[model samples]
Target chain A: QQQVKQSPQSLIVQKGGISIINCAYENTAFDYFPWYQQFPGKGPALLIAIRPDVSEKKEGRFTISFNKSAKQFSLHIMDSQPGDSATYFCAASSIKAAGNKLTFGGGTRVLVKP
Target chain B: DVKVTQSSRYLVKRTGEKVFLECVQDMDHENMFWYRQDPGLGLRLIYFSYDVKMKEKGDIPEGYSVSREKKERFSLILESASTNQTSMYLCASIPGPNTEAFFGQGTRLTVV
Candidate 1:
């Protein structure tokens, strides 16, 4: 029950369009959800995050839409650009997660076409 | 800037050899983690440390062991390097539970 399943292993989006990545979890204990963006030769960095009490949080072009009852959360990249092409990971963890452990999804390789 | 740094960017070792991957964080965070990244596997936690001399096995820790002698440094050791162990290893640190994790560039290990 510690798995976070992500879909659309790979995505291709036209520039100036919207890029969406979806993720689902099986655990209800998860209270915090964060999305990470990783470049080819770099480590992943925190992009945006949300708490279970909030339905959605937006930060510039990146937004996290969370659904508590459905056990799902998604990352929506508005005005997608080529520079946004990278592997995106969605993770879930409880406030008291062991070692602050995060359960990550397999990932989505996003390609923004110019 | 606060950061997590890995000792090596790339490493090559022969099968049956001992391998040690080192990581250090300057954030003085209480939580540190080691994960292996593969093509399809997003990031599999190998081990993590909450404090000095404290360690916990993660999801995949069968052939791997961890050492946390200090608060800022965490090391991952491979008992016997094997070809299957070749992958990108990443280190991360967090200030506390439910916080964002800072990661190192990653060490790509190749076992010959």
Candidate 2:
């Protein structure tokens, strides 16, 4: 069973527009939600993350809006740029089992056209 | 900055060959992980080590084994390489359970 499900396997957005990627989880025990960005031939890097307690968390141009009741979280990129084009992955994990057992959603490839 | 390094960027092996993939981290982190990325399946964990000489099986650990003799180095061994094992393997390390993980560039393994 896929613990986490992500939408829009591929997305195309114009530069300066907003880009959004959504993910849903079935496990209520999951407390940590993180998004990762991966470029071709490179490993994934942490982009932004949010805990269950917070409804929204923003860092610079990246924002993570989470709905605990809905069991959904989405990553919103403000003023998307061509440099932001990469594959994004949404992951969920519980603090008790967070060592390296993150449940990842199928990646979404985003293309920001300049 | 934390740095995780995989020994090889690319590797090729025969079906019956024994393969070893080595990973080293500079950050003195206590946790290390090995995951494989496929075209549509995304990243799936194979094994992880919480500390020296300690290992845990991840979701997919059927054809893999891990060894952590030192705190900084972790190794993944394939007893017998198979064509299905061909994929991009990534190594990661985290300071603690609640913290973010740093990843290596990844090693692309191709089994013939």
The model with the greatest lDDT is 1
Off by over 4 Å in 2: A98-100
> lDDT tens string, model 1, B28-95?
89999999998877898999888899998889998999999989999999999999999999999999
- Residue range B9-84, candidate 2, lDDT tens digits: 9999999899999999998999999999986577889999898998999989999999999999999999999999
Fraction of native contacts, model 2: 0.61
Which CAPRI tier for candidate 2?
A: medium
Q: What is the lDDT of residue A24 in candidate 1?
A: 96
| Model 1 Cα lDDT, one tens digit per residue, A54-102 | 9999999999999888899999999999999999999988877678898
Name the best candidate (by TM-score).
1
Candidate 2: which pairs clash?
none
Measured against the true chain A, the candidates' chain A TM-scores are 0.97, 0.96
The positional error of residue B41 in candidate 1, measured at the CA in angstroms, is: 1.2
- lDDT (0-100) at residue A52 of candidate 1? 91
